[model samples]
Target: MTSPGVHAFLIIVRVDRFTPEEKNTVDFIKKIFGDGAAKYCIVVFTREDQLEEGQTIDDFINSSDQLKELVQCCGNHKFAINNKLNGQPLKIKIDQLLRMIDQMVQSNRGKYYTNDMYQKIERQRKREQARQEEEDRKKKKAYEESLISTGREIGRQEAEERERERQKEQKSREKEPQKTEKPEKEQYSTREKICGCSCHKYPGVIHVVPCCSGTKFPFSLLGP
Candidate 1:
């Protein structure tokens, strides 16, 4: 009988004597459950006195492939119950199995099943960061280029201004007049002068006066 509240627990009880119907039931269980039934424990109940002198339960089921498959399907998890003894060991084993299941569930509690989703998110974040960095680099390069062009323009302007100032100075220098020094005046003394005239004081302005005979002054009498 299946309990509605105990969906995680699957109990399969075998009859005291094995029959075709019982074997068919076990087969049906295996077919229906498969690996899905690995969550449950396999409880094998047996009467201890029914066993042969040298035979063990492990030896008995070793030849049954179906039984082996059933145990393997449950991840080889099995607990034996001897009906002739107290059920303390079975209870303890069931408790331990439940604790293991609890631990498994706890360990996987925070685990995300979809690694692809996380990877996609991480990739997108990196791409966006790279794009932003590229944009920033372009903007910085453009700003530096602008500053270089401005500097060149300023240098050209200063050169033109200096050239204009030099031209203006050169033209002013050329337009100014150049001064010339006057020559010294010649000296004369009366005693050294010819015709005994005070040439220095009188500085005679000679007139060619005609005598009574109308004779002209000789050219040789004038100073050479």
Candidate 2:
């Protein structure tokens, strides 16, 4: 028979006689309560207690591998009880079982199960962030280098273009002609000559005069 209480006590009764329905009920109880079924203990209860009168619980458990395995699954906790009596032994066993539960709860206080997993996740996130930062740094450096190279190429082209324009201007100046200034003119006076006297048959003249101004000869005149 199973009873409901504030706290469940898992009592495993290893008995000689169990109906199929009772076995099924025990399986159902274990499934429903699970690990929350506290203060659990395995009791080897039987009407014939003489079978284990001289043997300890450990001795009997060790006598068979199946029994040893069962006890191990129950946290190696077992008790011998008389099925015909409800006495001090049962109370003492229950009290010890409760104390063991209290100790287990105390030992596990403030402890979590997923701490290692959380740490692993944090480390993974940091690694990924670092990888992304490195990639970004490489990309930015490559972009800056490309920009610098492009700027250099453009500057070189512009310098060559300026040099070409200068040369073209020089050639044009060489092909043009130069202009010069004209000189001034000068003035001069004209002179005239005349004869003073002439011989008709002999054709001899002794004085000379200017035709336009009437100037006389100075030295001698045969005829004036």
* Top candidate, metric TM-score: 1
Cα error of candidate 1 at position 108, Å: 20
Q: What is the overall TM-score of model 2 with all chains considered together?
A: 0.31
Count of backbone clashes for each model?
0, 0
Worst 10 residues of 1 by lDDT: 1-10
- Model 1 over residues 1-224: C-alpha lDDT tens digits? 23221223333534246555544544454344432334443435356446667877676556567666555654555444456554787577567656655543344452222334334545766787899999999999999999999999999999999999999999999999978888675343322332312233443533233322344444322331
Per-residue lDDT of model 2, residues 34-61, tens digit only: 4322224343434435455677556655
RMSD of 2: 23.6
TM-score of each: 0.33, 0.31
Off by over 4 Å in 1: 1-113, 181-224
Every model's Cα RMSD, please?
A: 23.0, 23.6
The positional error of residue 149 in candidate 1, measured at the CA in angstroms, is: 1.0
In candidate 2, which residue ranges exceed 4 Å CA deviation? 1-113, 181-224
